[model samples]
Target: MVRRWQPPWRRWSVRNRLMAMTAIPLAYLFFTFLWYAYHSRLSEVREELAERGPLVAKVLADSSEFSVIARRHDDLKPTINGLLRTDPSIHRIDVLDAQRRELVAAAARAPGGTAELRYYEAPILKRLMWVAMLGPDGKPYQKDRPAASGVTVETIGYVRVTMSPSALLLKQTRRFYVELLVGSLGLLACVLLAWQLAKGLDASLQASMQALREADAEKRRLIGKVNTAVEDERKSIALEIHDELNATLIAVRLEGQRIADLSPEGEVRDKAQSIIKLALGLYNSGRSLVRRLRPEVLDMLGLEGAVEELVRHYDSARSGCRFDLQARGDFSRLEGDIAISAYRIVQEALSNIVKHARATQASLSLALEQGELRIRIADNGRGFDAALASAGIGLVGMRERVYALNGSIALETSPEAGTLISIAMPIR
Candidate 1:
């Protein structure tokens, strides 16, 4: 079972969704605040207008020749004109008579009212904001922006001052817009900063995960190389012991047998037979050691045959122990690496059973279900602590090997219960 590595991008992502999530509310709230502030400033401007309106009216009325009708009317125009010039913000200085006839419309010097002017007037006083109608006072009137108190009495006429915003209002509006622009920019900057921060954090985590994966791969490569080298060394030593040493022992045994055949049935003959028996035992032990160093059956006969031969050897070597071995499902049909990995796990488990488990019987079973291959080795021995075994390096090595092949191993054992080792590897 070979597990392919997952790419970093596929594993997790933080950037895409966060930008939209953080940006929306910030923009909405900022615009809402600006809109409220804009209206508030306009209302304040109207209040300022209301405060200045009556003063202009009072000044004009006081200077007029009230006794003469034509002169008073004539006299009023100059006063209105002077006021208009004093504050260039004054758009139109219309002195309307009580009958609402236009006694004076200063802006008559320019073209008359357009539709835009009517729209401007529409929201003026009726919305409780008549004072705001003054166009910009241009410059001078800022110190004394007219506020309509509705304060004129004798009421021969009413003055309507439309301001082109006073310099102060103009400056304030500019400042407000500047502040609004700055605030919006600040908010956008904050969102970008947050996104960058999140992206950095995600990248750091991804880098750490990549480092871990690389380290794991490197460790596996080193372990595999080292294990292969050890096996090669073992094979070399086994060949030396078998081909050179074992042949000498066999020659000595044959010499003893020849001597026994020649001698009579006496003490010398019995000693020769004993020497032959001891030499044969030594040869068998040497053969077993050679097999342990590198099982030739594993390379030549495939995994299942090697396992069956190993079980038979174990059964012969340890006569008291009963072995129950079975190959279930398509055990013969597996990749060499997977089969070898499974074989090693079984070998290690059986070795552990023989060494640690003082058991009467042991069983080994393997099966393939779906795409996964499962191997189980159980013993009815006096079990040790599974926790300790799991924590130990030997068991950890076994598990690491399994993991390297993209498989899993589980050992179930306690002081009371017998040991059970199960491994599963995906073959497809």
Candidate 2:
């Protein structure tokens, strides 16, 4: 047999499951969105760095071109200050010749020493080459940019520019706060949506479970009604057969006896006796059938008496098997479905023992204690597996009958250890 599947999450109630479904998606999306934002910031910084290289190179080339060509030491400081006054971003500047000799330099010594420096170099272009390849902003020359021509010049030296990016780093820090604010807002939105969805899902599941529970209760009620109706019909049939049919059979038997007594002592007399014997056998069979249908002894003797009679009947009928019946409390008032269901349960169990158990001894108990009816039927026979008993139609009928009375049944069985069937019924 294939075992049933039990998922780990099934341990959680519907509410928790809904919460998880709601929260997990929002959490995933929040992290993923923040991750994308972080990478975007990195990419922006990289692009800014790329653009900075060209800007620094252009600044050096423009500021130092005339100074390097004329070899004027006095003009270098003014040129460097002019560059510094235009942009607060620059923290250091250096001008170098083609021979790598420093022509002029400026440094800002902060309390924390020099910030990390980035390097840039540009060659002083001849006047024609400058107009062709260099743009005014010191970017690569483009057709749309302004470049002056007709100036005579040549490559005098290379100008190097060094700059610190502390200001840019601080700007990025401010941007991080803005990014955090945006992320917080997005997370709040996601949480609100997720909570609403989770509540809706939980409500839906609760409604479904409620509907299913009502349906199940209704089904059990219907089954109990059907079982009671069938039982009533059986009782009627048994009464009809017992009262009318048995009387007719008895009358026929009495007539046969009369014929046997009147006839002469010969083959005719023997035939009459044979007819009487057959009629007697049929009467016995009809009595047994009536008992099977609905034992009249039940109504006459009460539950305890009926149970004792049943055990005695079984003990006499079956070979190599003993049936024991024990009881306590006043069972005379035991009536309605309770009585019928209990009697049928015992009847079916005994029939199974005779047909299948091959046991040497069996016992049945009917006790009323503390306003509850307890029934236990045990047999010392070659035991069977629980699967076999569960699959038995007889056991199934017994269970249904017991459940119709809102009772419970339990079975304890293993190979050669005998089977114990226990039942408890609420009498009040």
Candidate 3:
């Protein structure tokens, strides 16, 4: 099977993902606000410059009319200098006569080559009034009858003001920078808050996981105790059957034999012989049951010997199938629980092979290395689907026994293929 690729963010922990979700949108909004603010501030500064420039020129032009008419341009310099001193936006002021001749000019210090300059012009107007008066002949001269009062307005000179927008822009830039800094700080604060939240959630998740692990461990320990208790009870029953029941069977057989020998050749003698044979068969059956409940070879010869004996029994019983056993390392130092569980696991596997595998050949391998016991059982058989068979009593019992000892087991099998069962148990 091929695994599909996942985005890098998918691998992030819940905490990190949450932080990213919160921060990304906030960052975008913050930058968008800054962009709008920058443009809006720039437009406001430009508008202010436009309004201030034209107004300043009109005022200067009105003031300079008399100075330009009298040709006493020097008189206007003081007013021009005063206006320049009062307002920083005004870069230069010029007074020009009607003929476009420079009369007097006053310019503020150059702001720098990079300063943006704008020009505004306002025409200085002169008003003249013509009144009809008696001529030297003592009569009003009537060129065309004297019109109603004659007043005429004429442009005398111009006032041109040069305005620099650098000051306004600089002020706006400072404000913009401050706003940006504040926004950046706010974003940083949000990220920090997210990090703290994530940390808390992660801690809680870890605590939950730890509790679950402790509970599982406790469950396994309980299972181990139960298995041990069951085994102990089985041993007790086996001992009772071996010492008490077998002894009674032996006594019955001996009495039957005695009756047969003493009785003369008749139906009674034949009945006694039949009784003796029946007793012997019952005794043998009882022995086999005792062995099944608790194998004596396990205690006498340890795990390896017990397993070997079991294999031999199965091999002899099923002539059509062959059984093999391979062992490594010492089995004598194994703990009782580990030894018993391992033996049961192997027993269950072999039983499954015989009952369901329809196997012609099977092999069991055991190894003890680095404080761990490893066992493998394989068979050349018509295997069944492991998933379907997992719920079977035999496999479930094997799995529970292995889990009770905190061991691991893996099963590999498919239809028409051999089944392989592998287990690893920590002996220490």
Better of 1 and 2 by TM-score: 2
- Ranking of candidates on lDDT, top first: 3, 2, 1
Better of 2 and 3 by TM-score: 3
> How would you encode candidate 3's per-residue C-alpha lDDT over 259-307 as one tens digit per residue?
9999999999999999999989989998998888898899999999999
Top candidate on lDDT is 3
TM-scores across all candidates?
0.47, 0.53, 0.55
Considering every candidate listed, which one attains the maximal TM-score? Answer: 3
lDDT of each: 0.71, 0.79, 0.88
Residues 1-428, model 2: lDDT tens digits: 24579998988978778778877887888788778877777566556755776687786687666667778867888767776666444666667676768778775544112546566678866464324566656677566765665666666676666555565656776887798788889888877877777777888888999999888677767877997888889888888888898888889889989999999999988998998888889889988888888878888887877888888889999578998888989987776778877888888899999998889999988899777799999999988898777799999888877766677889999888899999988886
The residue-by-residue lDDT of candidate 1 on 1-428, one tens digit each, is 47689865564355554555567787788888898878878777666556555455445444442522353467666766777767544556665655667665675344333422211211011112234334356443344665443432344445555554454367569878987988888897988897887787777767887999999888877765665566678879988998998999999899999999999999999999999999999999999898888777877777888899888877777656777798867566687667766777778777777777878899999788768888888999998886688666667777877776667788898996898888888886
Model 2 misplaced regions, further than 4 Å:
1-201
RMSD of 1: 18.4
Mark the regions of model 1 whose C-alpha exceeds 4 Å error after superposition. Answer: 1-199, 263-271, 299-301, 312-323, 329-338, 357-362, 369-372, 379-386, 412-419, 426-428
lDDT of 1 at 200: 73
